[model samples]
Target: MPCPPAVRPGTPQWARCRAMYTSEETAALLGFSDGGVDEVLINEAHWTMRNLLLEQLDERAQMLTGRHKSLSMVEGVQHDDVDGIAFIGYHAGAGMEGVLAHTYLANSITGVWVNDVRASEGLLNSHVVAEYGVPVVLVTGDDLACEDALGYAPGALKVAVKDHVSRYAAVCRTPTRTAADIRAAAREAAALATRHQPVRGGPFTVELEFDAEHLAMASTVVPGVRRSGERKVAYTSETMYEGIRTFKAVTTIASAAVEEQYG
Candidate 1:
């Protein structure tokens, strides 16, 4: 497919963003064709390595290697950078009815909330990026995932590649159809990629519901996280930056606590 001319904002500022899963196709479809600036693809190690070797990529990419980065603990985004972002191949939050639904941990986490609003990864990451002035321009996933996004990035274009029939199954769409729809949406969504002033909404209270009682107890190993119930833990952070990383820690410790045949 031929690339479209770059989309421009009123000012000279360029766009930078992040995405994951099926991101290879999403990245190729967007790249500099949809938005003017380069994209920062966030995928697992294997996909990133494949992207590096294929040369199908347009500008440099990024794989969010965790912890102790020179700038941020996760190399997903940098402050004063990234104008817009997209969530690709995301699903419903844990305990939801979407296909392959789960939060950060596959089965350990049953639910998560930020200030009492039930949060999916889309909502949580949206909060993290808004702090740096980044806007969410596009989101692609199952229909429920798109519905879930309305709460987080209602202004962004949402493309539902499939309709959920169950947690592991959906009335899937043809790749050709989805690709065409996404391409159209991506092209139009480029205009929404402009950056804005950073937002500072502080004192975010994050709570997690685990599948097992032990998982909640394990989460308390992270400082500031405490037992909220037999299977829940809660913590408060002054910023989403701290809140997200702390959430990561809680999930990790909880996952490690899982035992075979006993959750």
Candidate 2:
């Protein structure tokens, strides 16, 4: 059958296309029967954890397929209509133990912390959504990833489809096993679907510690970001909204300075 209509451009529907499937699975898990699930498919980005094949997706989904979204992976969480989020295909943060572990720019960042909590992209985005009053209801990844979720999303359901041996290897489940697990978890997570009052936990202080000093030095070019020590940069903002944006800028600058072989 033909895919569901593409999310309309320049509208909130477009934004819905970019939420992680974990959110959709949460909606499904929690019994959101009234059009609550939307799927965003990113293209051409192969870090193994990404590159979701649209054709293989179940019929209940509507996919946003293409490239260059402003917020990238967690694109839809900011929308007022989105109630909760889920982190599907999510691994551990860079420097943490999991399969295909890394944060935003893959290998460039060694670690990121918000209010001193080590953050995965899921964890960071979870904090971002909390500012908007959205709950993370489900998370799926390796065993370590599920453990990580407990620290950030304690109430959320988690399914570990694999056991991590390294960044590139895992004791993986068959697709049949994993898919059933995801579907069941998605169904249950839907019950947690409900928005609450927006949070304003600002001024948020974010600290980034990179593997190299040059990366930290490069991040300092962004105004208000300053070196905290040899390989770390710190920045504060009035809100997590602003804090995350500044964090994005710092990562971008740091990523650009990475040497091909030395970094």
Candidates' C-alpha lDDT: 0.70, 0.70
lDDT of 1 by residue, 1-263 (tens): 11111111122221211122344345435632655555655543211122222233344654553344322322455556666776766778877778777777777788998899988888888888888888888888899999999999999998898999976568977776777777778777777888988888888999999888888988898999999898999999998988888987887788778886643
Angstrom error of the Cα, residue 47, model 1: value is: 11
Candidate 1 C-alpha error for residue 72, in Å:
9.7
Count of backbone clashes for each model? Answer: 0, 14
Best by lDDT: 1
Global lDDT of model 1: 0.70
Q: List, residue by residue over 73-153, the lDDT tens digit for candidate 2.
A: 566667676777777767799779887677776666778887787888877777778888888887888999999999888
Q: Against the true structure, what is each candidate's TM-score? A: 0.80, 0.79
Stretches of model 2 off by over 4 angstroms after superposition? 1-50, 65-68, 261-263
Q: Which pairs clash in the backbone of model 1?
A: none
Model 1 is weakest, by summed lDDT over 10 consecutive residues, at 1-10
